[model samples]
Target: MALKRSSSMKTQLVNGIQLQEFEQEEEINTSSSNNTPSEPAEAKAHTEPKYYTVEEAVETIGFGRFHVLLFVIMGSANIVEAMEIMLLAVVSPEIRCEWRLEDWQVALVSTMVFLGFMVFGVLCGYVADKYGRWKVVFGGFIWASYFSLLTSFSPSYGWFIFLRCMVGCGVAATSQGFILKTEFIPAKHRAFLLPLASIFWMLGSMLIIVLGMTVVPSMGWRWMIRFSIIPSIILIGLFLFIPESARFQVSAGNIKGAMSTLDWIARMNGVPLPEGELREPEVTERGNAFTLISPAYRRTSFLLWYTWFVASFIYYGSVLSSSELLEKNLLCVTDADAEHQIKHNHEEALCYCIPFNMADYQTLLISCLGEVALIPLNIALLNVFGRKASMAILLVLCAIFFMLVNICTTMFGFTVLLFLLRSVVSMNFNVVYIYTAEVYPTSVRSIGMGFCTSFSRVGGMIAPFIAQVLMSRSVIWAMSPFAAACVICAIGVVFMPIETRGRALLQHG
Candidate 1:
């Protein structure tokens, strides 16, 4: 009786399982039949490609070997710019003697380069935005190289001024290279790496000084200018290896080209391409001068332009005034009247082709090295304090140093103050670059940078007048304005509406 009952229970259990399976199948069929119209749509949705933005793609790739390569290649732009700008300060003393130029004329040589930089600054940005970054960069390299080479062969001061101005045009165009670089860099790496890129600038500044110590003294200023062309030549070749910025390409509506470039970057970096279709960046008003002044950007633009102007004024003031300061300290001119008299006599003579001695070069080199030494500090402040605070702090410190520099009675004292001044001013400049790149959207980035840089060149255009010309008359005139400008910039920086720390870049205006 028990065996029979066990056999019946086993049968019932198997039958129950079969019934449950049948019911589930029936329910599935009923559901599928009822939802047939939506079935294909759901399947289609599953099969469709995913979309991603440029920032999303960059984040996935992260910083890799490819970025390191880009950093070096794109950072070459800073190096080249530094060499050109520093060459003015290094070579001007010699040029003055060669042409029997007055102090104002000597100042104008430096002024003209920035004049061209100012005039073409906005234009280059527009061209870069409408066209592409690499084209502008590549063309700029060519334009600058040709004109810079011609500068060495300049027969008269007028030709030299014109050629230098043309070089400035190229330099202004190349400023877009920074924008191109900023696009590729992930936000996480921006604070550290962007400030670190100033190492290239420091290297370039030092290189010109080294050449000042060696080439200008030996082969003459022409040869030094001739030799500076070599970096441009090398850079033009390296530029071939790097691709156009994917961000710019996407914003400009060349999605396929952007995808290809991104794919190449992925391959080069030993990573897989991001798993999606590259979404087109949102359409916005094409970047123009008006876009910069739009309500969205107006206050930021105003503040940023002023900040750029101040940074350039203080930085170039420190640099151009270095030679004069060194001269004053070296002469041991304790009295203000005597210092003025010495400068007057010095300007009238214009006979010493190279005013810098071995000691002067050593001092200049020491001061320049301060830029490198303080870079780690700058990076720290950027990451810790954030961009706005860092800029304001540096500007304030710069102002204090600029004022303190006025009271230095000994070479050691002046060199120390100048070193601090260069360090802070350069740090502020680095912060400004990073901040501007972050604040603007991809569509108007280059134009925004160019516009701000144009204002900087305005400061640059005027800096020589004070640094080289007025500094010759009174130290008070040169240093005081830079100090005042720094204070004003510091105050203005506090009022910026946005803080770009760890912020994702905007794709559209």
Candidate 2:
């Protein structure tokens, strides 16, 4: 009876153990089935990012009415900026005559603008990258237009200088505007399209000349400045139409905003996103203008800044000194009697004179006209020789012209050589803008440009004093430094390791 009871207990215990093993196996299978598709799909949905690059966005958005409208409206800002720069030249003569201001004081008024650029350029750039490109555009234009208009009403030289300085501080948006345009353009078309902005710059300067010929002589430089605001006021209202950079929005982790921008771009471009979703561009950690100095970027960053300084030194140095250049040429053209006869008709006397001195407005107009050829030349040179070759060659050409300005003795020779010099230097300036934008990554593009431009403003601030001191001795003294600068920058271009031609914009430096 005891053996029979023990056998029944053992059978029951084994059956219970087997049942427990079977239930455990069934539960594991059920969990695996539930997780394999359901959890993995959910995890992937959660982990994968949606983002796009500038090039991809360009492909989707393309060059169409959207681009035309945006860039056109944006070009208005460039026009405003150009007018501000040339305005110093336009008003300097009148201010000098009216205030009985010394040559140094006239130069100081111009120098103050660049000084403001030196102070505020990097700050504006940082703000553009940290905040938004459109904000920089609007902010710059608003500051520039308001102060510029107020400048026309200045009661004294001190007030005029301060207001003009504010305009320079505001016009630092040139770098921001350049980057903003680049971020939207397609890679294949970038080099060609980017130079088109120069045309608007040219037009803005030419507008000042038109004012000089028509209104400036009759009314005054003040009225000309006030009249210049009409277009700017119109442009400010249109700022609402330009879109913020989708690339910037994405890097900022604003996915919804990026998407909304991308949708508008895609709708205009008539293309779908890659794999039905955008993927974030791979980038290093986010940083400020100083980030450009990191080990990876140090060589390129310093190189660009130095080159920009050199270019600005030569370009703005030449521009700011242009008023005096005409005076030098006039020495050979007019005797005491001719000068006496023309004193009353001086404005009308040179209105159409071939051998006459190039007035400040005329000099500025000639400078602007030079940009008309920059676009086509940029297309050919950038496409054929690549960025390095084009920039180096252009700088060399500029150097040759600067040397000619010193060598030439006659009025015709000075005028022709000076015109050519302005043209070549303008081309070089456009090249620098294109190259700077191409080299830096979107991560710090605007600030990087601003940093480089800020250094250029350093050169600009010193340019007037240098030109003033040098011109008193001889034109050669003023121009020699710029010739040396051109040579130095030309050499720098040869040493650059990267050529950004036909490549997508770098995501980060």
Candidate 3:
């Protein structure tokens, strides 16, 4: 009986072990059914939400091929605008002969134009921020075009000055064009593209030379003023086809419009909509003029304004003085008969001008070529070197070159040094625009840029008078003041913060 009981216990123990094994298997299956395949905790922790790719972001922001084309077209318009600003410089001799005016009177034409730029630049920024960029830009085009046409028909010097000032008021649209370009371009492309836009100004300078040497001399000074109207009309028509900035739309609380524009861009570029919703930029309660003076931006405003003044003082002073400088230099090289004839007859004046042959063209071309030559240097040095460093280097170099040109006696030495100085100075012109735009928050960017440009205009206005004073004595004497201006620019550059290049626009105080 004991053996039979032991055997029964053994059998029961085996059955219990089997039952335990089965229960373990069932529990494992149930857990497997309830739980997902375990992702490593580290992997889960590191996972990030995908944002749009660069191409996708560009499309989402409405920067497509069509937009690029529009940028080029508008850039050409900028070239035209610059041409108009320098127009008086080219024809100053003729205007002086016709009006029987003093050097100050010739200077007044630029002053009036810049004064209009100063007053209306702020107004345009306000309109651009509050209303829309297109309206201000279009209005400027129409206004400037009509007045430019009127400038061609002025019968008296007073009428001519009044019309030129009116043209200045109309040309306030140039600021709007810059505002649009800044708003439309993506952040990555902003710095490089913005500086490249200055190439248009150089192109405009070239156009002025072309017109002065060709059209104005062949036709009359009035025809040169008339030619200015063509660019305005063409640009106004092209602007009608370009859409308003999507960024501006978003800023103004028009998300639907912004999205629709984005959709078009996406379709155009064959890209998908980015995943996130668009966030509107904060709208400040500050008025346009007051915004520039607000405590948060006051220091920035002061610095940039002063820089503008200095830059304009140097740049416009140099540019306006160019015709006089060239004429004087030519006089040094030419005979008495040629000089006398050039002083009297408009056609003969330009045609038989000193540096009369390919030499003048070569000189102008070399100056312009100096601008193009700096592009690579900018690309290489601008990123690796900070804004302040690059600006300081350029400014110091410009000052050195200016001083060298002032003291040098040989024509070859003067031309080479002058070209180098201009090249260096031109780089600053491009850099300043990029710096001003980058430093300000988007909410007040246009205002900041407009103010900077306005101060630049003030410098331009003051330039002719300063040059007239200096040049009335000797070419060397005129350049002495410019050398001083260069030193001031160099000092300003040294004090500026080094945070502008490749930086996102800061929104906080």
TM-score of each: 0.90, 0.83, 0.81
**Which candidate do you rate higher for TM-score, 2 or 3?**
2
- Estimate the lDDT of model 3: 0.69
Tens-place lDDT per residue, model 1, 326-408, is 65432233543433334434545543443766777887888887787888899899889999999999999998988887674
Instruction: Tell me the tens digit of each residue's lDDT in model 3 across 172-275.
Output: 76667876766656666775676676677778777776776777656878887777677777877777767776656666667778777666766765676887
The better-scoring model by TM-score among 1 and 2 is 1
List pairs with backbone clashes in candidate 2: 51-278, 51-279
Query: Distance (Å) between predicted and true CA of 328, model 3?
Result: 3.3
Ranking by lDDT: 1, 2, 3
Q: Which of the predicted structures, 1 or 2, would earn the higher lDDT when compared with the native?
A: 1
Q: Which should have the higher lDDT, number 1 or number 3?
A: 1
Question: Model 2 off-target regions past 4 Å?
Answer: 1-54, 281-285, 328-337, 340-364, 409-413
RMSD of 3: 5.9
Q: Write out the backbone clash pairs for model 3.
A: none
